[model samples]
Target: MTAAERRASGSLAIIFAARMLGLFLVLPVFALEAARYPGGNDAALVGMAMGIYGLTQGILQIPYGLASDRYGRKRVIALGLLVFAAGSFVAAAAPSVWWLVAGRSLQGAGAVSAAVTALLADQTRDVVRTKAMALVGASIGLMFAVSLVAAPMLVEVIGLHGLFTITGLLALGCIAVVFWWTPPAPVQHANVPRGRLADVLAHGPLLRLDVGVFVLHAVQLAMWMAVPALLVQAGLDKDRHWQVYLPTVVASFVAMGAVFALERRGYLRAVFLAAIGIVLLAQLGFLLAARAPSLPVLTALLFFFFCGFNVLEATQPSLVSRLAPPAARGAALGVYNTLQSLGFFAGGAVGGWLAKNVGSAGLFGAAALMMLVWLLAAWHMRAPQTPKTAEEVLADEAEAG
Candidate 1:
């Protein structure tokens, strides 16, 4: 890679890292904190607060990306960050679950993920685009790890309200980075046909990928809804949750190496199915833990869960990139991302509702069901041919998955 590409990737990675940190900081602690506020006792309302961001994000991603293509990437990104910061402030000050829901909804309204992907596409060449997207993915993975470590400490010091305040300020700071640090704008081509919205919606492979992403994120959020509480019930303190998390994270990272190895050795399909099977087992473990409530068992179970999750996380986008055709890659990715956002929201809401009404066991049962459904859906999916170009591969894989 050239110096310029390296610089661009580094800056964007940091920017994404900060943004995700702000976005995810609340997830680990929100349920317990929100319970202190009015209407927090209602599981459905709390779910709404947690998941509203996904709803708006999914709804607006296409429009935001299209607008960026027409107007310009930087300006749209700046505007989105500003909106996100504003929503953060609102969430920080929210007095009721309804207000929190409103804030989360506002936060999702930013919907700049698609625009950011498009910007990277415009900024980088096709050969290196997959690497750039992987940088973005790595940023997210790092932020998730950091947030899990930092959240309990932050909540201990600043509380959830203060955390929201800090997030808002941090988001505002990202605006400056956008203006000063990112690369110069891409020169627009008049003759290159842009991906069509209708075409993106109509593609069968993209739709399958979209459903897969939705299930992936939905299961993720739903599991967390019960997992933390389960940990506490098992006698682990909030601060000490890292004892379980850190090792699992490391092990998962190590496990993901095998996934890459499989891909390099042309066993992508087998690896993918194995990862999903592990996830299925994790869900089953959760169901058992909910029934029995044992710390050692839960801890052991989570190790396997993270292993599966990390593998899937590392490989899914690569597959998506492999699947997508060149002409429609961006649009396909946009749709895939939107579904992911929707899953985040739906998972939280559904999990919270089930936890409240049917007990924690039911929450895991539902998550397990979702995984089973995804596994079934994937059973018929052929391993898509690797496209010659990364962009074509991404588009095709995304469609195929």
Candidate 2:
């Protein structure tokens, strides 16, 4: 990659990581901590507080990316970051669970993920785009691992309010990085076609990928609705939950490496289907183990869950970037992310409801059904083409120019 490509990819990856860290950091502690707030003890309201970000994020993701395509990437991103920072501050000072929910909704309203991703695509050549996206993906995975381990420790020192304060500060820092270090957006030709939401919605393969992401994240949020409480019930202290998470996350990374190797060897479709199958099985495992609730069994189940989750998380966006029409990449990704956020909202709301009414076992069972549907959809989906060589990408660019 060129120096410009490296700078753009590396800087944007960190920015994305920073944003995700803020979100994931709260997940581990929110259920227990929020109970201290007014109206926090209501399971439904707590779930809404946790997942409300997804509602606004889902509503705005496509509009933000579409705006970026027309207006400029950095402008949209910077504005979004400012909004995010404001939301963080709001949450930090919130006196009630309802206020926290409103704050979380505002955080989602920023909706810059599609814009940042579109900017990465804008800055890199086709040949290097996948690798750049992979770097971003790996950073996200790393942040998630770090958040699981660090959140408990950090909460011990700063409390949840302090964590929100830190996240707000990080957003301000990301805004500075955008202005100072990020690359300029590429200029578009007057005659080049811009992507339409309607077109993206109509595309079959893209729709499939969107559904896959939706199911993946929904199941994830649903599982979290129960997993932390399960750990505590199994005799692990909330502070020491990291012992299980840290090891499982590390093992999942190793598993991801193996999956990536298989994809490189032309087993993309096979591996994709297998990964979805594993996710389904893991959910089933949770359902069964929910009855007995043993630490060893839950820990084993978590390892399998993360193994599938990590691979899917890394694979989905790269696939979207590759399969999207060159002109409509931003819109395509926007739709993709919109569905993902919707999944988050659905997972938390529905999962929390299920946990409260039907129990955690029912929640896992529902998640398993969702994955079973995804597995079938994935089975019919086509594998992405082999990535172009740098020389080939350059030749194509030369011809287009």
Candidate 3:
């Protein structure tokens, strides 16, 4: 990547990380913290409040993405951030659980993922886009780890309201980063034929990716709910689980260099399928670890999970950009993220049910099964075409005409 690409990728990764941190920060503590509010007694209702954010975010993603194409990426993103900040502040000041739900719902309404990712795609050359996206992926994983450690400590100091306030501030901070640091908007390819929702919806490969993301996030959200308890059973205290998570997440990055190497060698399909296999292996490991409850075993399993998780995260989005019509890239990603958000929402409900009726092993078993399914689907996916230059793009269009 050139210096400009590095700067763009770095700044956008931070922006992505900050938004996700705000979301993840609440997950570890929301149920506990919500109990302090009025009407927090009903567990189902409290769960509803948290789920609403994902629901609303899922609902709005495509519209926001389409709007970005019509208007502009930066404008749409800025507006979304403002709305997100407002939602955070509302959540902070809520007097009751229902209010908290309303606030969370508001937070989800500002969905800007499509626009943000589209801009990142626009600024970076395709040859380096996956590496750029890897940075974003790593940041997200890092934030999840940081949240696990920080949320517990931060909640103790400032309590739930303070956490909401911080989330709002983080959203506001992203707004500043957007205008001041992110690369200037790329010139839209207006001469390119406009694309439709059908273009994305009818595409088989994108559909596969959409399913893959859905499974990835659903498993991630559901598995984490059980993983912490497994760590506890392994003789690690709840407070000290970070000792396992932080190191595993950090160590996983060491494997990513190999992913980049293989991708550059034009083995992208091979790498993609292998990453899915690694995650499946991790899930199977979790199944065994759940039975025996060994800290060492669980830690090693986590390393493998993050390794596969980060690779899939980077490659999937890069492929979406490469494969989608130029005019419809944002819409395609919106669909991608919508499934992701839905997976998160569904994972909680499904995971809780599996854990309750079956056990930790059952939950991990289900997740492993899903990964196997995804791997099978991804096996048929075509390797991405090489990056096209402007002349190649125009020439191809002219040839088709």
Candidate 4:
């Protein structure tokens, strides 16, 4: 990789990490801590408060990414960060669950993942793009671990409000990094054909992966609605839940080494489907945990969940990037993130509604059902062929001629 590529990847990784740390911090505690507010007693409302961010994010990701093409990546990103920071502060000051929902909605409105990813893709070559994306992924994985440790402890210090304050500050810091540190993007992104969104939307493999991401994230947020309480029932205090999370998350990362090993052995499709199956298994485990709520049982289930979650998180975006045309990469990813965000929204809102009416049994059962559908669809997915740049395609055409 070139020096500029290194700088871009590193800078973007840090930016993503900082923003995600804020989100991850809330996840470990929000289901439990949200009850402290006035409207928080309503499980459905609490779910809304937790998941509204995804709704706003899903609504605007495509528009935001397209805007960056006409506008500028850094400028749009900075503006987005400011909006996120505002949302964070708003959440920090939220008086009730309703206000918290509004704040989370505003936070989602700052959908910058598409722009950030497009910016990184612009600066890096296809050959190394996976590694760059993986850097971003690893940073996020690290943040998830850090938040698991920090949130339970910190929530005790300043509560969710303080975490939101820190979240806002992190966004402010990211804005500075974007403007000053990120490498200048290549002009090729603009020179290339501004491909139609239909081309991306109509893509078959891309659509399959999109559905998979949606289900994956939906189940992710949905499960949290009950997991924290189950942990409490298993005799761990809310604050000490990290004892389970840190080890499970860490161990899960190690287990994912086998996933990569399987991929290297030419079983990409098999491994991909298996990962979904693993997630499904974990969900069923959660369903049983809803009955018994044993600490050791819950701990093992979490390990399986993290293992599946991490593998999916790393694979899907990279696959989308590989499958889409370079010129239309932004649009493809926008569509991907949109579904992902909506899954988050559905998970939170629907999960909350389900939990309120049917309890954790119904919630996990629904999640497992979604995964089953995704696994079936994913079964037909073809392994992605490594894509060439515009230059490579043109050169090949000329050579053939």
Candidate 5:
């Protein structure tokens, strides 16, 4: 990467990290905390409070990205961050479960993920764009891991209200970074035509990626709905749950490194398939562990589950960007991200229902079933064509004309 590319990637990472930290910081702590409020004792209601952000984000992400095209990236992003901060304050002060849901939904309305991604695409030339995105992806993954560890401690120290205040401050911090860290936005690409809904929907490869993202996040949220409780039931203290998490996260890194090595050796498709297979195996492991009710057994199984989840979480967006056209990249990502958000909403609701009605075993069984479906869908998916560098593709197009 050139100096400019490095700067662009770093600036984007800072912005992405700040915005995402606010959202993810609450994930590990919310369900248990919200249960203390009125109506929060109901599992489904708590799930709603926890997952409502996905619903609103799913609805507005595309519109937000498209609006950025006309109104400019920084302006759209700044507005979204302001709204997100407002929602954070609402959530911090919410007294009832319904009010928490409302606040979460308001937070989702900020929905600038697609817009931010589009701006990143605009800033970097194609050859280095994937590397740039990898930085962003890694930032998000790191934030999720950090949240898993930090949220509980932070909650204990300052309470959930303080967490929300911190999130609001973080949003304002992103606004400052936008101006101080990033170069001025580029002139819009003349050849990159406006995104069309019909065309974006018709793109089969991108649709497959969309499904992959939806299933991925759905499974993620659903697992958390029950996994933490399962850990506590297994005699692991809530605070010490990190013991299981830390090791599993470390193992996932090792596993992902091996897969990347395979990809570099020209076996990308095999590695992708293998990752899905591992996820299926992990789901089955979760189901079996739930049935046995052994603490040691469940802990072992969770380590397996995270290895698969972490790998998939890191890889899916690269697939989406590879499949989508340059002109429609924003729209394609918008649709893909929306599906992911919906998964969170649906997963929380369904996971809670299954756990409440049928118990933890049933919840794991349902997640396993979803993974099974995703595996089937993936089996039929054609591997994406490797994308040409920006310079190469542009040269070819000019010569053809």
Candidate 6:
């Protein structure tokens, strides 16, 4: 990558990390914190508040991406961040669980993930795009780990409302980074053909990657619906939950590096499938651990889960960028992100219900079933070919015409 690509990728990765940190910060504490609000006692409503961001995010991702394609990535991203900050402030001031849900929905309405990712694709060359995406993925995983540790401590210091306020401020700060630091996107001809949503939708390999992302996130959100409470039951205090998270996150990063090495060695498909298998095994382990409920057992299981999660998170987007038509990259990513958000919403709502009605074991069982299906889909997915250069993309289009 050139200096400009590095700057763009670094700035964008920070922007992505900051927004994600805000979201993940709430996950560790929201279920317990919401109990103080009106309607919080209803498990379903609390879950809805937790997951409503996904609902709005799912609904608006494609539109945001399309707007980016037509207008410009930076402009769309700035607008999205402002909306996110507004939503964060609303969430910070919410007097009831339902209000928090509304705020969360607003937060999701700011969906700029597709736009940011598209810009990254635009800035980096095909040869280095995977590494750039990996950096972004690593930032997200690191943020999640940091949030897990920090949320408990922060909530103790500032409370949930204060946390939301900080999240709003963070989003506002990212807006500055975008305009001042990130490089401008290279201009393409106005008359150049762009990818149609229908074309991306009809593509088989892209759909398979979409399903992979959906199931990956769905299982993650679903598992969290129970994991926090389970940690409490296993003798860890809610405030001290980071003790488990900290070590597991460190170990997962180490494991993820090894997995990346396999991909570098041209074993992308094998590593991808194996990562799914690890997730399945982790879910199954969670189910068995629920019966016996030990902190050590639960920690080991979560470590395995994060390993799989980090690997999949890093690999999937790169595959999407490589496989999709260059002209429609933003739209394809929009569809991909929409599915990912839907998975988050579904996992939270359904997982909460399962936890409330059937118990934690049942939630894990459901997640395990989803992973089994994803594994099958991934098993049949062909490896994505390397991405073409800009000249190649234009030449291919010319040849087709």
Considering summed lDDT, which 10 consecutive residues are worst modelled in model 4?
A: 187-196
Model 4 C-alpha lDDT per residue in residues 1-401, reported as the tens digit of each score: 78999999999999999999999999988977889998888999999999999999999888877776666678778888999999999999999888899889999998998889888878887666766776787788889989999998899999999999999999999999998999876665455666358888889899988889999999999999999889998899887888998899888877776755555455767767888999999999999889989999999999999888888887787788778877777788788888999999999999999999999999999999999999888888887654565778999999999
Every model: Cα RMSD to truth: 5.1, 3.0, 4.1, 3.4, 3.5, 4.1
Clashing pairs in 3: none
Model 6 over residues 37-74: C-alpha lDDT tens digits?
99989888888888888889999999988788878899
Off by over 4 Å in 2: 391-401
- Residue-wise lDDT of candidate 1 within 1-401, one digit each (tens)? 56777767777777777888887788888888888899999878888889889889888777776666667778878898888888999999998889999888988888777767666666665445555666676677767777888888899898888988888887888788878988876766767656566777886766776788799889988887788989999899888886777677666666565554455456777877887888899998889889767888988888898777766665565555556654555566678778888998899788788888998888888888888898888766666654355666798999999
Per-residue lDDT of candidate 2, residues 286-396 (tens digit):
999888788999999999988888778767787887888877888988988999999999888888899889999999999999999998887889877777676778999
Q: Name the lDDT of candidate 4.
A: 0.87
TM-score of each: 0.89, 0.94, 0.90, 0.93, 0.91, 0.95
Off by over 4 Å in 1: 1-4, 122-131, 325-327, 382-401
> How far out, in Å, is residue 178 in model 6?
0.8
**Candidate 5 lDDT by residue in tens digits, 79-191:** 98888889988988988989889888988888888778777777776545556776786677677677778888999998777788888889888888877887777877666
Error of 1 at 306 (Å): 2.3
Off by over 4 Å in 4: 189-191, 258-265, 387-401
lDDT of all predictions, in order shown?
A: 0.77, 0.87, 0.86, 0.87, 0.77, 0.88
Error of 4 at 309 (Å): 1.0
Of candidate 5, the 10-residue stretch with the lowest lDDT total is 259-268
**What is the C-alpha local distance difference test score of candidate 6?**
0.88
Return the top candidate by lDDT. Answer: 6
Worst 10 residues of 1 by lDDT: 257-266
* TM-score for predicted model 4 compared with the true structure: 0.93
Candidate 2 clashing pairs?
Answer: none
